[model samples]
Target: MTELPRDRVRELLDAVLDDEASDRDDMARRVYISPFHFSRQFRLGTYESPVALRRRVILERAAWRLRRGDSVTDVALSEGYESVEGFSRAFSRAFGFPPSAAERTSTHWLPAPNGIHFHPPTSLWVDSAEAPRSSMDPTTQMVHHDIDDTRYLLELAGKVAVRDYDRPLLPRHVVLGWDGPEESIAAVLEHLIWSKEVWLASIDGADVPARGGRDIGALAARHETAAPRFISAVQRIAAEDRWGDVLIDALCDPPESFVLGSVISHVLTFSAYRRQVVRQMLRNVGVEADQGDPIMWLRTRHQPSHER
Candidate 1:
């Protein structure tokens, strides 16, 4: 099979998440490839057909919604299934449990293929290969680690009470960069996401979107979208041996240029600091936030069976 470009594959994956690539022809058109070639390349890269991948993603999302207390009928319709019975059957077959059992059981419903994995609340990620430590490059590993840590932090944020999420955590005059005295836990989280967006746009040579006004749930969704894109962008840069290259920020009046490595380091450092602030804010509001330590999260996620 011919190799498919990773960036194009990322575009197709995003289209899948947006429910805009259901048709093979449409996906091929989006990538400027023929349908046959697109299918061949997709299967070669992901080990699943586009249709199968979409179905699995939708089902995974349905399972997540069910666990989150969405009614079965609503999930069914939202996923485009004709009826609850059909959705239940598909859900049962994919997860080995009927939709009714989702709320009561915490389980990984299906094994993701080699390259692709499901991230909760409706996201699919194309991860690095599962190779021995010596085989993977340092940059790729670091990117994966950051992505995992961010996901863990989002999970912790999900536990914050809605009332506490937007409550002021600092006086209005005390500002952190763009955040001001009206800063709440939500504002801090939003800034964290906004920073990521701006850095990613710089990397991609795209314009940054306007920031703020997103709730906690919307921020989580943005993280889900941004994390994978950032990973793919970093990996592409690493593949091209361009981490040391300078990216000029035309949006800046002085037109500042930053070394790609410095930009990445800044993002990682700022994300850690902001996450800690959010955790502290959650604690002050009586929510039992996790320690938000990446090492602990890694250990729990990849622990040996003997240790367990």
Candidate 2:
């Protein structure tokens, strides 16, 4: 595994998080790289595009300040938003609530594909477990994207009515034969969580876990519980270089065997399919969801501006 040079990554991160650095071109200039290569290298190292990381961490700071009773206008202006209304809209979109509601949420940190976030007073917090210790592996990137995207979809689904949630969006659609039809948003989301639960159980040699409820909230809770375990399990497997290792699953009738590598691959393959299905279902039901593309999901393209 090739790791990015820490010094270069640190320098790039410093440029990105600098209060004076607001544009990708400026960040590129600071790092003495062209904007295109800078963005690419930053994503390669940080698992997030520079602009998206800056924007999200800034909003995270704004959320923290708002929670501490900072005026929305003050925080908004300090965070570079031109107006309080603009700030509120962005805040609401990112946090799922207005600035005024910031005090109600426990943590200001939003869901980041990379674990980079605002950490108190004036610093960034990177979760060592979530952020790759080595170079960003393609497998790790996809796994992180899949989990984060599923969580994002669940958040969007939580706002829809139960009737619409259960409405069939695809006729006769089924990914795994035994999992049954995944034609509705609820069913797709259910299998998304279940796939993790069942696989993890088999991996751990534990009994098959009970299926979670179909409610978006319940599914969200189950995901919160299952996602980290799934990530940790994958991380452990990778750290031990156990991808090619085989496992005997007593959970399967008369027992079955699987290579760790293929197990995760299978889950990721179908989870990707189900995620897009849910996204389309959300759009059809009058809720907006992203394109669910890994390219788009992992990075954002910012307009060029050489403000430095």
Best by TM-score: 2
- Model 2 spans > 4 angstroms off: 1-131, 300-308
**Local accuracy by lDDT, each model:** 0.67, 0.81
In candidate 2, what residue range of length 10 has the lowest lDDT sum? Answer: 299-308
Candidate 2 achieves a global lDDT of: 0.81
Q: How many backbone clashes does every candidate have? A: 1, 0
What value does the lDDT take at residue 187 in candidate 1?
Answer: 74
1-308 in candidate 2: lDDT tens per residue?
A: 99865566678889898888869899999989898678656755665667777888899999999989998889999889999899989899678789999988899987665567899999889877556544557887788788767867887898888788888889899887987888898989999999999999888788888886879768976786577568778888998999999999898788888999999999999999888888888888899987887787545422222321
Model 1 scores a C-alpha lDDT of 0.67
Tens-digit lDDT track for model 1 on 194-299? 7778888777777766664567667766765566567666656666878799999986667899998888878877777777777788788777777866566546
Q: Which pairs of residues clash in candidate 2, taking residues 3 or more apart in a chain or in different chains?
A: none
